[model samples]
Target: MTRAFIFPGQGSQAVGMGQELAKSHSVAREVFQEVDDALGQNLSRLMFEGPIEELTLTENAQPALMAASLAVVRVLEKDGNMDFAKTARFVAGHSLGEYSALTAAGALDLADAARLLKARGLAMQEAVPVGIGAMAALLGLDIGPVEELVAEAQAKSVDGGICVVANDNADGQVVLSGHKEAVEAAIEVAKEKGVKKAMLLPVSAPFHCPLMQPAADVMAEKLTEVVIAPPRVPLVANVTASEVSDPDSIRRLLVEQVTGRVRWRECVLYMGEQGVTELVELGTGKILTGMVRRINREMTGSAVQGSQDIEAFLASL
Candidate 1:
């Protein structure tokens, strides 16, 4: 069956995520070490033995998640003898996970990915003050209704704060991001309009909205210093929800993604339309895999996070 490998973004991280893999596989340990050396910090330690508050910080979580995902990829390659270019039809990621996808497809170096994510996380966090911006998940609402609600909320917002669709996650799940007041306004509007649930997310800053323009600018400069090669396989980008293989395009889209909606549902559907029958999530959690199943029941979704999951997946191949 045709397959596309996917990676998870924020909210997938947790303490002890890659500890078992690092213990079971030498290659996994090397991946974590490479990330630590690249950043001049003991990130692996943070991942394995986290004071959850510090590990969950945007700066730490971004690269930490990538490191965990890459560790799984390295083990799958060494022990499973799997080559992504030969084994998978496409690769994709959500938000920061896009960097992991590019790294996995050999378009980006692991060290470069780590440093870039660190910068991205820092920039995103610093774009807006901690309490100035917010994000909210509006459940049981489609994109069209959510967009209307965003417009209404923006109109009602204090000081004209912006509110917009941040993530069109699934058929019934969408996220809104903007100034805290605007997002809170959206939550109230969503409740008034009879949404199943509307509540603020625990994210530190509003992501994938105009409020993050400053962070996007920072990434634009940061991206220019990095070398991006064409991936061994096509990457389904978050901003475009389509396959892209050109190095220049990938670089450009990475910047846009900082303030652009993560069109995850569309990305999954696009892959399915392109004959991808299975989506394998190689990361810390089964979040993306679960989303894949929600996006299309006909498309099989599986995750390979631990040693046993990796072995089972490889054996299936």
Candidate 2:
């Protein structure tokens, strides 16, 4: 079956993630070490033994998740003898996981990816005052209806009110992000429209919305200084949800993604349309794998997070 390698984003992190893999494999351990050197901090320690709150910090979590995903990819290459350049048709990631996908696809170096994510996380956190912005998931409603609701909520709102779809995650699950009052209003509207659930996300910032414009600006500056190579495999970007191999386009899309909708559902559908029958999630959790299945039941999903998983995947291959 044709395959695509995908990576997970925030919310998939957990204490002790990648610890077992590191303990068992030298390559995995080295990946963590490289990230630690790049960031000039012992982030792997935090990932292995977290205070939960500290590890959950956007600055720490962003690069930490990427490190874990890359560690898995490194191990797979060393032990599994699988070459993504030849085997995978496309690579994709959710949110910050896009950096992980690029690193795996050879478009970015792990060190640069880690440092950029750290800067991105801090910039995003500082974009808007914490209590001013919020995010909420509107379940059981398609994107078409949610867009209409968001417009209505914005129109009725006061001030520079903005509530936009952040993640078109899957069928019937679209997450909204923007001003607190506007988001709350949208949640009420969603409930009134017979949505199954509409609730606030415990996020530090209203990510993937206009509120993150400052963060986008910060990323634009940071990305310009860093080199971006053409990926070995095509990347289905988060903002566009389509294949993009050009380095310049990839760089611009990465910045736009800060304030653009993470068209995850569309990305999965596009991959399926291109005949990618199986998707492999390389990270701590199977969040993207679950989303892939929901987006297209015809596609199969698998995850490689530990040594056993790698062995099984290689044996299957």
Candidate 3:
């Protein structure tokens, strides 16, 4: 049976994430320290003792999550001799988690991963002004219907209410993003159409839509500064739902992901079809692990978030 290593994206972070790992393992602490050094600040403190609001900021949360994921991986490697090629057949991530996946697969160093995530987070935050854009989750809606709803909402706007489907998260769950008015309108329309739930998301900005074009542009320039190497393992890209490791291709897709739909369900389905019977999430939250269970119930799922979890996994092996 093939195995895959997946990573969680944004929205999975919380205060005190990776705290146990930091306190338990020197290797894990080193990962956090490396990230702090790379960013020239103590992000670990913010993550572990967050003022909540500060850690929730896009700029801090993005790399903070990446650092958490890397810390888990470092502890796993330091405490458990889990071979990447032997233990994992594929690697995939949700949105920002893609950077963690690349770093785990040896495509990028931890320092570069931290730096890139910081750049991405700041760029995305600056893409649109606060409170101007919004995101809503539309349940029980297909992609085609959701796109139609977005178009309808956009058309209803007198100005630029550019509502668009951002994330096709599951079979019937989609996240739409654009102007606040447009998103609210789409929610009302979806509720009228018998959608189970249409609720506004608690996010700093409307991400993964046309409004993120400015962020994509920023990433295009900032990514050129980082040295990206081909992955040691095949990566299931978010855009294509297929495995690719070409450095140029990875760079192109990273920029596109700024405004592209996070095809998470598709990526997991692809891994299952490609013979991944085991999926492990190395990070602060089990969000991606839960999604994988929904996508492929037969696959054995594991989450390594602390030194003890890593040790338990190693013992099992």
**lDDT for 261 (candidate 2):** 97
Return whichever of 1 and 3 wins on TM-score.
Answer: 1
lDDT of 1: 0.94
lDDT of candidate 3 over 157-212, digit per residue (tens): 77767788787776677898888988999898887788888999999899988899
Model 3 vs truth, CA RMSD: 1.5
Model 2's C-alpha root-mean-square deviation from the true structure amounts to 0.8
Displacement of the residue 140 alpha carbon in candidate 3, Å = 3.0
* Per-residue lDDT of model 2, residues 1-317, tens digit only: 89999999999999999999999999999999999999999999999999889999999999999999999999888767888788899999999999999999999999999999999999999999979999999889999999999988788787758899999999998999999999999998888888999999999999999999999999999999999999999999999999999999999999999999999999999999999999999998988887777789999999989888988888877
| Least well predicted 10-residue stretch by lDDT in candidate 3 | 287-296
Tell me which residue pairs clash in candidate 3. Answer: none
Tell me the lDDT of model 1 at 27: 96
For model 2, the run of ten residues with the poorest summed lDDT: 152-161
Clash count for each candidate, listed in order shown: 0, 0, 0
- Per-model TM-score, in order, reads 0.98, 0.99, 0.95
108-227 per-residue lDDT for model 1 (tens digits): 999999999999999999998889999999899999999998888877766998888999999999999988888898899999999999999998999999889999999999999999
